[model samples]
Each structure stands twice: as structure tokens, then as C-alpha cells.
Target: MDDQQNDAAGQAATRHAADRVLDAGALRALAHPLRVRIYDILSQYGPQTASTLAEHLGESSGSTSYHLRALARHALIQECADRGSGRERWWERPVGGVSFTRPAGARTPSERSATQLVMSEFFRHRQDRLLDFVMHSEEAEEDDWSKGAMVSTATARLTPEQLEELSGRIMAIIDETVDRHRDQKGERVRPVSIRADLFPLATLEESS
Candidate 1:
């Protein structure tokens, strides 16, 4: 399939084979805004040392190091044993989809708050990235990529069951494509973000 089609399909499939639903403790660990940012960086840019992450985040290495350790405590991230050494250990987000949905029986106020914080931070990060891309897409458009790059939105009405079935099929195609090219690397290969937002719109009465 083409890049645009593939990206649209992949984004539609938010849950995947690598998805991991967060438990209460993991949600709490990831609730902090700084930790969420750190996790996002690792997810997007691959492995990095505390120093590099701090530099990119405009925070002190010490501050980033503390958050990294906290994240590691809950296994949200882990050491890259093959890279870095000593105090400058490399850290990476384990390859998986982190589902922020609270686990069953985790309805305590604290757990709910944690889940909200993490989800908010996660969406904020995604929005910021998308905005950044929009601001810079003109530069990219000058190249061959413009043909496949697009920004689009649409609305539809569907029953709950239909939505579930549609999303499942989208994800199945995405999974097959991703599994085949998960490790692709070459001179022309670059990381691309796939984004699709499929959710119910608030009704007029609900908005009021």
C-alpha cells in the first residue's frame, strides 16, 4: 500500500499487538508531566542518555535522571545494556503501546487522577508534535514527500458495534504492514508519525 494509505490505516488502529494496559501503579508512575515527556521522547527518538534527553527537554541532566529512574522503577522504561556505560546509562521505552485506561477495580480517586494526568499529557504531547509538523511541512513539501503527506479530517455516524468492527479491520492491515517493516533502515528511511483520531463527537445537548 501507499504511504498515505498505510499511515491512515495505522493511525486508525490505535490498539495493536504490542499494547499494554497500564495498571494503577504504572499509571501513577507515568502521571507526572515530566516523566510523560521523557517517556514520549524515548518512544519517538529511540534510546538516549539522561544528558541528551535533558538537553533536548531544556532541563538539567540531574532532573531528567531522577525522572528516568522513577519511570524505570515501574518498568515503563529500561536500561539499554548494549549502549552507554556507568552513570551515563542509555534508556529506552520498551517497544509497546501504553494504554492509559485504568484497570478494573481501579476507581479510587487517586488512581483516576493518575490516569487522567497521564492521558492528558499523552494527548498534549501528540498535539504539540502535530502542530510542529504543520508549521514545518512546507519545507518538507519541497521534496518528494509532499505527494504522500496530507492533513485530513472527517466525521461519521455509526453504531458502537460497527465502529468496533471497522477499527479492528483497520488495525489488522496496519499490523501486517508494520510487522513486515518494523526494523527497516536505510539512507532514505526516516521516522514518520501516523495519526488518526476516530471518536464520537459531543452532541449539542452534551456540549451545553
Candidate 2:
């Protein structure tokens, strides 16, 4: 099968494979705004030291190190085998990426509460990232990346199952695109942050 056909055939199976589950502790650990920012930086920039992350985020190295250790304790990140020594440790996410949903095997309302915190942070980070691009994209666009930077919004009426399928398909398409350029030799290949927001309008907020 060609790449397109392969993606179509494996879409159902591959979507879940790319995302690992988070437990209550892990969810809570990542709910902080700074922790979320640190995770995003590491995921996008590859392995990073606490010092580098601190510099990028304008945080103190001590603060970054504390958060990095917390993320590691929950297995959200790990030490890089090929980089760093002594105090300048490096960190990266696991080979399998993580997804934000209800915690796996959560039994209590308290566990679900952690999920809420994580969900809140998720929305905050998503908005901040889009805002960053919008606020400063003029300088970046001069380098020929403007076409890829955009906010796409669409509304649709569908059942929850349909929404789930749509989410899977969107992620599958993204996976296919990333895998295509992941290993090939290229000069201008740059990281592109993509976000998808799909939901019905009627229930955008919780009922009182």
C-alpha cells in the first residue's frame, strides 16, 4: 500500500498507539502553568537541560529544575542517555507521546479532579501558544512560514461517537505528515505546532 492507503488502513489502530495514558498523580503533576510550558518546550525542542529551558521561559534555573524533577517523578519525562552530566541533566518525553483525557483507571472523584486541573491547564497553554504566534508572527512570517501558521475553527453537529472519530482522523493525518518528514534529509524542515479544537457550540460551557 502507498502512504495514503497505509494511513487509512492503520488510522484506527495508530491513533491510540501514539498516546499513553496518565494517572491521577501524573495529571496533577503537569497541571501547573510552568510545568505545562516546560513540557511543551522539551517536546518541541527535543532533549533540553533545565538551564536552557529556564532561559527560554525566563524562569530561574532552580525553579525549572524543581519542576523537571516533579515531571520525572511522574514519568512524564526522563533523563537523556546521550546528554548531560552531573547537575546539568537533560530531559525528554517518552518515545510514545502522551494524551490528555480522564486518568486511566481513576476510581474516585478526587482522581477525576486532577483531570480537571490538567484540562484547565491544557486550554490555557493552547491559548497562550496561539496568542504568542498571533502577537509576534510578523517577524516569523518574513521567513516564509506564514502559510502554515493559522487558526482554523469550524462548528458541526454530531454525536459524541462522531466527534471521537473526527478527532482520531485528525490525529492520524497529523501522524502521517510528521512521519513523512521525520527521517528524511532536509534543510528547511522546521517544527510546526498544530492544534485542533472540535466541539459542538450548544454545550461549549457547562450547564448551571
Candidate 3:
């Protein structure tokens, strides 16, 4: 995959982007663990074909192809018209954030189930990535990355309004930084995962 082309596509996609909130159908479509993995790979690594995905996933090309088509039917993934030839199709995830948060309404049991599954798989994947990096950091961490890296945790108490405000501020900073550097390419440049997680922990009473 060409990094520059991928970044250019990402820049264009972000320029016209609105966060995609998964509907019940899309939620169900992505509830499978393999599908979630496929989606995550494209998001993190850029465009790929079914064969390439299978190579990364340790699954058969036929199996990956089937899931890829299922995802495409829901417009969660699309064929790269500029990249594929004949039966060899290249697929890429459309850039921008995808929210699993349901809108204000009553959701069916199936929808709720789908939501849980999707969220579970997505978070599990994130956890695996974090663990992988930590496990190999001794060998993989270059001087620059090690110096630039941060891994810390802090706890704070705040009201819902305060928390919301803080979250908005954090996201604004992230968005600005990403927008400014989304298209950056250089000999030393690399893809970095920037994660932000902000949520209220359960009170002692609630836990009990």
C-alpha cells in the first residue's frame, strides 16, 4: 500500500467528513469479531485486498472475501476504483470516526445485543494492540519513540458537565493535530495510534 496515497485519501475524506453513527443494521453487520478486525486493519493500515487481509488475519481468502462483501453491502467498506483490476479488488475503509452510540430512542433486544457485541470486539482489539506494544516495547521502542511516548493514568472527580467540557477540549486538541498532519509523509514518518478514553467510573455504592 502506498502511504502517501492513503494519506491523501484520508485528508480528502476528513475534509468532507461527518462522524458515522452505526444504525441497528450496521451494528449487526459489524457484530462479528472477524468483521471488526477487518475494519480495524483498514482503518489503521490503509487500503488492502481480501488476500492481503487473509494473510494478516490467518483466515482463508474465501472467508475474508465473503465478510468483505457483507461489509460492503452496508457501505461500511468500499472498493477502490482506482486500485483494483479484474477479480483482484482493493478495498478501503472510508475515513472518519464511527460511533456506536445509539440515538435517543427505544432499541430492540437484537439491536442492543448487536451493540454489545460490536463494542466488546472493538475494545478487545484495542486492548490487544496496547498489550502487544507493551510486550515488545523493550525491543521495538526506538530512542525517538521512547522519548516521545507516554503511558500514565490519573483519576479525577468531576460533575457530568465538567467531564463533558473536558472531553470536548481533549477532542478539539486531537482533531486539530490530526487535521494539520493527516497528510504528512517522510522517511521517518509512521502511523501512530492516539487513543483518548474518558468515562465515569462506578461509585462504591453502585458497584456494591
Candidate 4:
């Protein structure tokens, strides 16, 4: 087998071995903004000390350490054996990926509110990062950059069934593409954010 095939197979194996579901408590624990940020950092850079995480997030060491412990409590992350002096602890995300889902039991009003708050904060954080990138691109060449730009919005005439099928296809395409390129490594290539958003159009009556 080729190098690409070997890498793909290895990733598939790792993904299969990883946990695919998060309990409500685990999801709630991971929903915190600081914890999410720390997870993203660790996923990109591997294990890191709390001090290092604090420096990267511009947070106090105490605050970062607290959040790290909360994440550990939920099994979202774990202490790594490789680092830390006598007192400090280094950590890494334990699972290959985290999947969020509504639990089996009906959610209480408070639980529903908590879930909404968590999702809202997560998306707001993502939107802020996208806005920051656009705002900071003043020095970038317009013509050169325009070639790499994309802005697409469409309103399709389709039944609900068709819409559902389309959504599933789109998600599958995204998953495949992300999995394909996830393990590529080189000095010239670095991490790039690829965000996808999909939702049904709101009716005029609903808007009014």
C-alpha cells in the first residue's frame, strides 16, 4: 500500500477505537468556552502544560488549570506522562473526537437552556474567529486573495424529503474531505479553518 493509503487506514483504526458519544454531563463539561479553547489547542499541538495553555489563551494559570481539571473530570482530556515538573501537569484530549447528542431522557427546562447556551457560545466563538481573520487581512493582496475566496448562498425549490437527502449528502462530503486531509504533514502546510453552516430558510410569516 502507498503512504497515503497507510495513513488513511491508521486514522480509520484510531477513529474506530475512540469514543463516539458524550453523555449529557460530559457534553456540559466540554461546553465551557475556555475548555473548548484548550481542547482545540491541545488537538493541534499535542499535549501541553497548563502554564503554556494559559500563555496562549492570555488567561491566568490558575483559571486555565481549573478548567483543565474540569475537562479531565469529564474524561474529555487526561494527564500525559511526558511532561510537568513536581507540581505542574501536562494534558491532552483523550478521544480522537467528541460527538454531541441529545440524551435519551427528556430534557428538563434547565437542561435545555444549558444546551442552548453551550451551543450559542461555541458558534459565537467560531464566528468571532472568522470575523477576526477578515478584519486582519488588510495587508493581503486583493486580486491574489480573491482567487481563493468563496461566498455561496442558494435557495432551492425542493420538498422536505429532498432537503433532508441533500443535507445528508453535504455532510458526507464534508466528513470525507476532512478525514482525507487530516493527517497530512509538512513545513509548508499548516492548519486552516473550514467552516460549514446549513439551515432551512425561514418563512416570511415566521420572520414577521
Clashes in predicted model 3: 0
- Report the lDDT of model 4 for residue 143: 50
Listed per candidate, the RMSD to the true structure in angstroms reads 4.7, 3.9, 7.3, 5.9
Q: Taking the tens digit of each residue's C-alpha lDDT, what string does model 3 give over 1-208?
A: 2565445545544543577878888888888999999999988777899999999999999999999999998989999989989889999988677776642332888888888888888889999988887887888567787668777778999899777556655666677688788768889888788898888999899999
Regarding lDDT, does 1 or 2 come out ahead?
1
In model 2, the runs with Cα more than 4 Å from the true position are 1-14, 102-106, 137-143, 159-162, 182-187, 203-208
Q: Write the per-residue lDDT of candidate 1 for residues 66-176, one digit (tens) a residue.
A: 999999999999999798878679999886666756433467889988887887888898989789888988887777666677789877799897676567656666566
- TM-score, model 4 to reference: 0.72
Lowest summed lDDT window (length 10), candidate 1? 96-105
Candidate models: Cα lDDT each: 0.80, 0.77, 0.82, 0.70
Task: Estimate, for each residue in 20-94, the C-alpha lDDT of model 4 and write its tens digit.
Answer: 666668767876778878877777667888899989999999999999999899888899877776798889876
Task: Tell me, by lDDT, which candidate is best.
Answer: 3
Clashes of 2: 0
Task: List TM-scores for all candidates, in order.
Answer: 0.83, 0.78, 0.84, 0.72
- Please give the distance, in angstroms, between residue 155's alpha carbon in candidate 1 and its true position after superposition: 1.6
**Candidate 4 off by > 4 Å:** 1-21, 43-47, 80-89, 94-106, 142-149
